[model samples]
Target: MLTIAPAQAPSAADLWAVLTALRLLDDAAEDAAAARIEAARLTDETRWQAAGPRRLRQALTEYTVHLARLADELWFQRDQIARNALG
Candidate 1:
């Protein structure tokens, strides 16, 4: 038989760090979304003719969507953490 140790509670500093990181992630997600829009506009305007502007735009759009989903997940986690901490 084996015994497992109980999980330790997170410290205030740890929670603060996680919250800060979440904020940064949210900011990055917003930036990525803006970049995706700009990429699409540039590709459509024919000014970003860099051999594969369409491909670049597609990749940026995908990246932006992924970042947005990740931000949503992190926000949910942050909310859960807050609820737990408060209760």
Candidate 2:
């Protein structure tokens, strides 16, 4: 929640503008990446104990890799878009 300063009261347009400027879209990718990594580590550790050492951890390993790759691709595209817009 953003509080409007007494000196700079926000208008209806300002509030609407904030709605359009959703920051979560940009953060989603990074959040997914971190979540994936943490999930994978925990899953792998759990599996290692479950039945001795295993080569694969279905729940976490695959998702972790996928998420990391997705984050890289998303950020890369975002940066490229910014550069293109500026140039």
Candidate 3:
């Protein structure tokens, strides 16, 4: 007769790898935010007279919020994995 075992949870190293990737993604999001700010500053007042600047800022804000949420979730997961390892 053949038998099967239950699948194991992710190892600490695996969790670390996910955390590292999340950090990299956060770094990229930060870079994007900086670039967006610089681009807005470089735009002329005439362009701001239109709706472009307002729309761009709104989009940037939304994207930043999304990134923040993702980062928060990743941090939460990383902490949970660490606690599981310890206890």
Candidate 4:
């Protein structure tokens, strides 16, 4: 998902929303990882049903990283805007 920060100053509300979404995504990734581990424990050597959950966990991990980058960029941009305002 592509998140475009607003052209205007970043509001506290916007940051809060992003943080909440990130938390939920983190929780889901953790659950998926747990499921993968359980599947590994329960399944036989020949069984490979955990692949889907494993892939999901990886994807979620990547998504979290992407969101974190976005958040960082948002803060940097907000800081730049503030500096420009101060000058």
Candidate 5:
């Protein structure tokens, strides 16, 4: 599948919505990263523990991976808009 999404220049209202969505997506990615960091710290705190902390780390790993992918996709779309506008 194509990783980049095409973009169309939006009207003022649509642009606002797009910006808001981008902000939210960025925030989500950041939150996921924070979760992963927290999970790492938790693991460090209990090195021998294999159940809850490991599960939490796994969840954060999944969340961060997915959100980072989404953030990349969204940023690609946003950049496409800039390229279109420039060209």
Candidate 6:
């Protein structure tokens, strides 16, 4: 006969850590959005400038894109954790 063990409930400390992580991820996402907006504004303002500023703006934009993607993944993970916790 095969037997299955019941799932253990998360400890208070474990739940606290998860909640803290979720908050941090939310904050990071907000910061990423803000950075993207600032980058767009700066790029527009420096549109008539020389190549150096343009290159810097391009790099900033690329980094912000990566940050946004990371934030998205974190948020998805947060949601999955919350759902699993509830179950």
Looking at candidate 6, what is the lDDT of residue 39? 66
lDDT of the candidates, in the order given? 0.65, 0.65, 0.61, 0.56, 0.63, 0.75
lDDT winner between 1 and 6, please give it: 6
- TM-scores for every predicted model: 0.49, 0.55, 0.46, 0.44, 0.51, 0.69
**Clashing residue pairs for model 4:** none
- The candidate maximizing lDDT is 6
Summarize candidate 3's per-residue lDDT along 1-87 as a digit string, tens digits: 988998687788986786676566566656655654554454333244458777776666666566566656655665665566544
By TM-score: ranked, best first: 6, 2, 5, 1, 3, 4
- For all candidates, the clash counts are 0, 0, 0, 0, 0, 0
What value does the lDDT take at residue 30 in candidate 6? 77
lDDT, model 3, position 80: 67
Residue lDDT tens for model 4, 36-83: 555444432333358896666566556555555655555565555445
lDDT of 6 at 41: 72
Model 4 / residue 41 / CA error / Å: 21
Candidate 2's displacement at residue 69, Å, is: 0.7
Clashing pairs in 6: none
Per-residue lDDT of 3 in model 3: 89
2 versus 3: better TM-score goes to? 2
Give, for candidate 3, the lowest lDDT window spanning 10 residues: 39-48
Candidate 1: Cα lDDT at 56: 78
User: Candidate 2: where are CA atoms >4 Å away?
Assistant: 1-25, 48-56
Off by over 4 Å in 4: 1-49
Instruction: Tell me the tens digit of each residue's lDDT in model 1 across 1-87.
Output: 999998788899987876776677567656755665665565456545576876776676666566556656656765675566544
State model 6's lDDT.
Answer: 0.75
- As a TM-score, model 4 comes out at 0.44
Question: Could you say which candidate leads in TM-score?
Answer: 6
lDDT of 5: 0.63
Work out how many backbone clashes candidate 2 has: 0
Candidate 3 Cα misplacement greater than 4 A, ranges: 1-47
